[model samples]
Target: MIRKKLNLFLVSLWSVWMLQSCGNPPLVDSTDLVIYGGTSAAITAAVQAKKMGKSVIIVSPDKHLGGLTSGGLGWSDTGKKEVIGGLSREFYQRVYDKYQQENAWKWEAKSDFGNKGQGTPALDGEFKTMWIFEPHVAEEVYEEWIAELGIEVLRDEWLDRETGVTVENGKITAIRTLSGKEFKGKMFMDATYEGDLMAAAGVSYHVGREANSVYSEEWNGVQTGVYHHRHHFQVLDQPIDPYWIPGDPSSGLLPRISAEHPGIKGEGDDKVQAYCFRMCMSNHPDNRIPFPRPANYDSTQYELLVRIFDAGWDEWFDKFDLIPNRKTDTNNHGPFSSDNIGMNYDYPEASYERRKEIIQEHRDYQSGLLYFVQNDPRIPEKTQIAFKEWGLAKDEFVDNDHWPHQIYVREARRMIGTYVMTENELLQKWPTPQSVGMGSYTIDSHNIQRYVDENGHVQNEGDIGVPLPGPYEIAYGSLIPKKEECSNLVVPVAVSASHIAFGSIRMEPVFMILGQSATTAAMMALDQGIAVQDLSYTSLRERLLADGQVLTMEDRIIAK
Candidate 1:
């Protein structure tokens, strides 16, 4: 009886503490637009909405803004800079403005920073654009823009998926956060990597790769044999043993190797491309933090890596992509790197606490792998020494202990909107509809699963890196749900697209462009009092072109 009373008292105290932490629920307020993400898209959307004479608030699930841009993805994956215009190009130009100052270069000399980038110069003096930047600098730019726009951003306000979204006659009237703060809005934009808002708002979405036959496209599904990138195992050189005891099936498969078949080629499955945190490493000793030995560090987890190294795979520093100063945006490379393949299949629809657990596991796996490569004697001495020279940049992600807060969620819940952007549309075989933005990046996807091959050797599957013929326009319909299911929401980041097509449209710059377009449509909808789908393409096109959005190529524009 005494113990029961003590438990009740403790529970009562905890409930009171939780209520205090969340703060008193704000009086229900209304805005013209409520963007439901703190990503680069969300920031740009809020700015656009504010500029278009609409009162807007950013209800962000993240504490920090700019998502991957402010994360360690400083090595921008820009396909063609000519296609990037309006707010997207403005973002890069702002990055240039920041780096143009003399004090921006702290760790290294400006001249030492040679003009190197993906298909363009790192710093374009004529265009006033800086593609490569530090994570902190990108975050600073986002904050500066929000402050300048006087846009209110409610950080750490997680959306309540259950009983929080109030819908009236197929429209979302208001959305309440997990903390009980309600935000009512006339229009909404779901700019999250995971389409949490869209999913909860009764919008249909897909979570995995669609079969090639589903969209009648060539590269849309389970690609077991297509190894476009160098992420697969060096199986051509030698068949690495999948089992602990070579050629023994009863001995069980090695760690990180899946036991299930990789599924039929060109068939759909729930597997998603691997996710990894882009590590910002620095060679400068003063600004480098040595890879800490993660708690529960198990060297045995990396036995597969040992086998990979033995097979002459020495491309460890292949993706230590240089950004700014002395920092490098280190990402997954080789067969066994930062990508936690086949681990995040459930992350798209996972509960918040469950997602946290998954994030911690990824953190442990990455940190342990780093520690193993640098400190383990089993690793080649030369490789170990080379890895030891690089460490996490001390100046970046300071709040998260120099670790990137955002994980690279390559693909998640892609909303199945009015017009699904498929590989056919991206490859230009089928004509794309009503252009809102352009995506020029390659149809790139990281490895999905590390499975044992038919030869009984471990092989990585589903690593596609097919470059597109040219830049393609993304449709406005891809951002809006079917007219019956939520009429007010616009999903930019997780736009309606097949897995392969999303691989191209999922770049950060494209998200910013789509965000601007979505908000523009939202403002128009507010003024005219109509559904987003009901907006005419002619008017939307004129407005977008007026705002300096590159809707089409120069020849296409002339032809039209």
Candidate 2:
């Protein structure tokens, strides 16, 4: 304990020294726009602002450019491609232009990039498939945008958040980091998944699942009876008894099942969505990097998975979604997949070191999972052999031990903005106003937690997979806070969505689309010298339409 405290003191001292060494960008009183986050949306928004002749700076915690789009979420969820326009479309067109080059494909022949070039129906369109790509490729596209616009970027600088600085009046007077460097701007956009800037700015947001009663949302909170997919291995005869003693667990606790029973159908709980690393896996014999057992490996933790393997649950392909370059953006599916739920409760609000520990725990759990799938004797020989051939991709995310630096944070603190998009809005009860983009994916939420059922069996809950009737417009109002909340601020990724409604619209493509729209709004607000909320809807709507944004499905622009 003494040594630990001394080490902590030393580390704090070192941090201070490093901050002083890094120095600060000249303290400016204001800029035309200041965007926070290194998300794809942040980049797109900055590019849009630059295009509109607005001086913009991106304050990011990331060393790289795009977030998930380049961070192993290559199997993109582009819901309504036709509605994606403006700078978002420009990004894909750039992807197409890259493939047009003869040297882009090293192993695969250029001409052979043919028929499959159309890509997934939901993901790709006539322009190109920017959705499915290698990490470096996506980063390059973003870097090009930065180069073209010459936008200033501050990398690896985290927001001090709790005590760094404050915004006064309609204008932000000072914004400081833990490092004590300050940034001030006229307009700020929190284009982050975590909503760090929003939280710091005192914006109201919720961090967990809301009750079904809250917004009359059909698919919210615990959902045990609804077996949306064949994720559970319970169907296998002699189902893995969710008990510690094989039958009697006055003995103790089981591997994955909690002692608590699955919660009520419509009850609200402090359950944030699950998180997992999007393993960039490959089967290429020469390029394959075998999944290594993590430093703190624990085989006992994987006993449930071993049971599933014993049962004839052979479809390893269930959670293995594909990506470019012979790799997969493997995801969690069913009750027991990669989502280490019930484990990340403190992530959104935790301190930096605690968050690191959580990240390591997830990494250890998932890596151990891969190792078990490949080498464990309990696994079917057929499954084992197939798994052995696949391993983490070699050429991706080299800095973070070949693992994607970010997790697929399915849901986090959602801001309750002026226009809270409820299920009613997306379900088409009321038409969305000022469509910046459109979304049509099913309101999908992965399992939130696993617990023992009343029947004394383990079950997963909070996994909803309901399809939307059709594409619906995402309102411009959703992206901006109420004028009184923060006049110059715009939120894209953490836009106003009720817990369940955000499930469909929170795709990377939608984030990118909204980022472009948010930036457009930022630049427009600057041009007209008005708050984002005070902008004339007629003029803003017209500009968005002219830029090819799908404001509404119906071809009515001026709402005449």
Candidate with best TM-score: 1
Using all chains and alpha carbons, the TM-scores for the candidates as numbered come to: 0.94, 0.91
Q: Candidate 1 clashing pairs?
A: none
lDDT tens digits by residue: candidate 1, 37-65: 98999988998898898899999999999
The TM-score between candidate 1 and the true structure equals 0.94
- Give the true-structure RMSD of model 1: 7.6
Global lDDT of each candidate: 0.90, 0.76
Total clashing pairs for each candidate: 0, 0
> lDDT at 301 for candidate 1?
90
